[model samples]
Target chain A: MNARRLAEEIFVPHRLVMIAVAIGLLVWAGMAMRWHWIPRYYDLALQGLWRTIWLLGLSCLFGFMLAVPLGLAQAAGPRILAAPARAFCTVIRGTPILLQLWLIYYGIGSLFPQFPWIRESELWPYLRQAWPYALLALTLSFAGYEGEVMRGAFKSVPGGQLEAARSMGMGRFAIFRRIWFPQALQRALPTLGGETVLQLKATPLVATITVIDIYAVSSRVRQDTFIIYEPLLLLALIYLVIAGALALAFKLLEQRFNRGMVG
Target chain B: MLDWLYALWPGLETSVGLLSLQPPGWGGNLLRGAVASLQIALGAFALGLVIGTFGALGKLHGGPVTRDLLSVYTVVVRAVPELILILILYYAGTDLLNQALQAMGRRPVEISGVVAGIAVLGIVQGAYATEVLRGAIQSVPRGQLEAARAYGMGSVQVLRRVTFPAMLPLALPGLSNLWLIATKDTALLAIVGFSELTLETRQAAGSTRAYFTFFLAAGAIYLTMTLVSARLFNWIEARYRRGQVRQ
Candidate 1:
């Protein structure tokens, strides 16, 4: 009758069966003739997996680096700077990442011919490459979202702790370095981890802009071989594995950071 | 300044021309595409809302068999990429269904772009919606439900009159956010050759090679829709909060 008892009774056995059935179905699917399509293009699939890793890793690194400064500024800077940064966050958050990608890759690229300055600029060569454009768009978009998370984390650091550091003759930068940063990082990790996983899923959108990520390669393989589901199913499996690893790493990090909290 | 203006004018003119609603203009195409996109998104959202509400309810109160099945459905849909889902549904959904139906001695059926888009997006949205609805339902006060039971109200009566109303306030913000996501996701329907705004913009860009202008316009349109919806949601939130105060 109580909520806890009901939850335990209903959820425990159900979850076990769910896990078992999922694993059984996956193994059965793996062993079936349907998997023949995968072996024929094993090399391509591997290449696709490699590309997915590379893109997600580089994009996340770039995005995190951009996010930190932007977030800090948005939180602590003068209104003039913070207002625009806030607006940037709002606009980016409000729209679709797909349109952002298209705007940068095809939309901006198409302007090069008309803008003589852009055409002649040294950056044009780099901008012409699809990967850079995809990377740039992804970085900017993630920066907007992660900036908000970081701001929330920074704000969550207790005022009393900050004052204590200040009273100990710690300068603003030193106080931030020694106290604020670590605490904020710890508080922000879970949300950041979730966002990173979401970003990993978003890597496939780069395929639309012709980045040849895993999804692109899978589609190419499907097109070349006329095997529809196999390549996609394999790609989905690889994504699941990557997401599982990320989730595990985040859990470990959370546990390590969670020490001394309760006491 | 005049020279800069002159240089930009031609491309801008062409873009505006393309987006015009007049015959032989690309604006008409984009408008039609926007309508199709809206239809798919709205249809998907409606279906997803239904599935999500039921799924959340089932996960909360259903038997073990139902709970496990719903959880599996949610997890798989959440894990799989939206684009992959769209591709699978476009390519295999109708065929698989037709094969099963034929074995049942029913005629084979073709799934249209609209139907496929709605089905795929609905399934995907339903995954997130289940979480949203479940959280909202859980947030409703246990005391309220207990009070309803004290008054001899059955589960159905309590759900209809008390639980649903309380949950609506909590659920509206999340549902609006999901609606925006659904609208944006219809962009992926472009791969299936659905004549959504994104697809129309792509075609116009490809044909004219005025890609920058067209896409910028498309981006502006998308931003406008998002901004308007956000304001609308704010208004709804305020209205609901006022109603709560009166209650």
Candidate 2:
């Protein structure tokens, strides 16, 4: 086929060109601001961005770790564990994450000082900080919502495959590892990507508790400079870059994992 | 022994550090806040339904430009932090409105916090709703439309009678999920000084120095709303699924 025809057949949009134009506009805006404004506030912005990444990364890591067991419990047949797990998921998923954050940061944080054991403990300092509470809230939020996604994925795995593995003299652990894990993870990948994006968005809520994430820095900048749109525009562009990168990364990872599977 | 009992009942309110949820106190404020939260959620959901319907229609049938424009809208809304979006919209919306008024030699007008809150939440929720509805509409079988057309039904008639009724069963589950999200998104409105549940709880907590009591009260109220809504949506889903064979 001719090059033009082949290009049409490939069904590629002008997305790369559009992305380039967006980046160019962002750079141009940055340079325009850098003459005086960005130089003065660059450190603050960078610090806030760093904190945002740290908050999101740690919460997502711990939350995903905690979510696996929660997800498993929901799918597990044993009523003893599953009932509580089900209730936990329902409560967490049902309520707003902001409410959860406030409940932890304000409600529990205030109550902590009253307990002599809690106050005297070595862990008291960490618990006293807003970041820890924010982390806890975000983690709980993730486990609640993402746990459901994973549970659904787990259920999607064909029972026949597990039965087949069992009949092959495979131990329960071996059967789960070989037959269930891969299929569930593969099924869960897309949903998990969306959840991670949401977790990233939720990172901004930490700022409400006075943790200086990117949104906090932008708010500070807006207040200090009294230039409402500039700081916000810059912050939005930064988020756009981060979100685009995340989406691209997830796409690549999905392709890598799905290799040799039916397209 | 009483101290130990107090520890178990931290917010019991019979003594120092006791939490209480009874009426004629913080409970009233918290419930009022819950009412405000529900109001905003309902308003936003209603607005989202309208925007989402048009958005889905545009994506499904409109020109390439409309599709690209809507794709950008969905992507940008989904990607951005909703809190940031609301803040930007709230501030910029006021500023622009004031500017326009100034140009017309009119007095500078303050945007109502409730209106701004509902508008921003509705706009954001609409993006997700669009995607949900688009998927739902697409899931309706093509044969149904063809069959309706064969009966000499017009496109609008088919859409009203056949297409809508068919898609509602598929769409209700997703729309209910969006409704839950809309309810939660209202909590973010508290950050902008909206007199919602979170803000009310904060005020009560700050003044009384009873952060634990008020926040916990607020959390319970929110949980009650969410759980009740979940049950309600499940009923609605069942109603929509009437006559359909279960899988």
Candidate 3:
């Protein structure tokens, strides 16, 4: 297609209409802010944004760490080990993350109160906090997803390469460290990047459990000010910007990893 | 523990009473809530199928503008967290439309929970569905279309008889996945005070404080629904694939 046609196709009327509607809503929101119909709570917004960032960062770190070994085990372990791991992955994958969060936060807390070790530990205080519950839920959920992605990537590594490494008299650990891990990491980057973006979006669910993320803050702003769309629109725009940037960064990383493969 | 297990076996007799058909009993309420959840899912899935089919068609055939439009729609809808979408659609949807109508000197609008739930879920499902449908349509052999044209079939006729039927077998699996997602997302609609199974379970748990029992029951309901639907999808898939063979 020609450039003009391409542009036109990309800017189709339905989408344009939606964007126009969004812009109109934003303009109305701005007017609401100007007239003090919507309160300007810059501090809360900033704090909420920071909380969102921290939640995503910590959750992704923990999730990825847990995922790597679990994924490797699932891909390579004996039947006894792999069966339970596979079942764990399947159950986590099949169930709703929100339900899992609710169950862990409330059910475990209420059920296991009499366990002395749990009650006496320093970790109790952290575990008792809603944020930790949120973190645990997000981490476990993403671990399941990323584990599957890693498993696929590991399987995709050519058998000949591993055989070649073994034939060269390299130890298993050395071969895995030098050959398998790097190649699998490269192969898994795109999927992992997508999951990271997903995790960013998923962090807002933390607000439902009272973790005071950006969406929660926005909801509070709406509740306090009785201004409906402004806070949500602003929050949505912030999310869009973050997600779009992540998409671009991942695309660049993918291209870098794929540099020599295509040509 | 053995004695306790024996007692619990007889204690299971009261399980029926626990499921009795009255207030303070779960049987009626849980069943009703499950039905409502199913209704919400069905509505969302139907709407998603409609939106997805058209969106996919536009993406595949409408040129670059359409493709880009679909791309943005898919990206934005998918990237925005489902919970946030539910909240925005549930609360702001009502307020914004009502205010807009009032500003226009018209009657105010009320967005019902069912409508809001379906709208949000349908939009969410459509994002994935668009990709599925687009892929399925693109996978249809170009030669088939050319053959149809040679037979003097019009575009509409070709779509109806040749393209759509061919796409259906390929699209069925993806559509099934979207259906499962929509079904699961009905759980989120409980936040908006929808009397779905999850909300009913929450209410039961709050009142009885048997949080474990109620939540376990809710999980069971979800699992049952998922398994049943999965079987149904599998049957349909088998039926669809009957005449086809692997090359």
CAPRI tier for the interface of model 3: acceptable
How do the residues B1-247 of candidate 3 rate in per-residue lDDT, one tens digit apiece? Answer: 3567558687454544556678657868888888988998999998888899889889877876577768888988877878777767767678788999999999986677778888888888888888899999999899999999999999999999999888888989988878888887888887767888888877777776666666767777777787788889999988877887655
Off-target runs (Cα >4 Å) in candidate 2 are A1-35, A115-121, B1-11, B15-24
* Clashing residue pairs for model 2: B11-B18, B11-B19, B12-B19, B13-B18
Alpha-carbon lDDT of model 1:
0.83
How well is each residue in A49-126 modelled by candidate 1, as lDDT tens digits?
787788778878888887777778787878888888788887777667887888788876666667888878998888
Error of 3 at B245 (Å): 5.1
* Among all candidates shown, the one with the greatest TM-score: 2
User: What C-alpha RMSD does candidate 1 show over the true interface residues after superposing them?
Assistant: 1.9
Lowest lDDT block of 10, candidate 2 chain A: A9-18
| Tens digits of lDDT, candidate 2, A1-263 | 68989777435455455557778987887666633567887898899999988888888889888787788888864889888888888888877898789888877888788899998999988887789999899999998887887788888998898888989999988987887878888899888888888888888889989998889988887787777778887787788888888888889889888998886
Native contacts recovered, in order, as a fraction for each?
Answer: 0.59, 0.77, 0.36
Clash count (model 3, backbone only): 5
The deviation in Å at residue A217 for candidate 1 is 2.1
Which CAPRI tier for candidate 1? medium
Ranking by TM-score: 2, 1, 3
- Model 3 CA lDDT for position A214: 86
lDDT of 1 by residue, B140-232 (tens): 999999999999999999999999988988999999988888888988888667889998888987887777767777777777777888799
Judged by whole-model lDDT over C-alpha atoms, candidate 3 comes out at 0.81
Docking class of 2: medium
TM-score of 1: 0.89
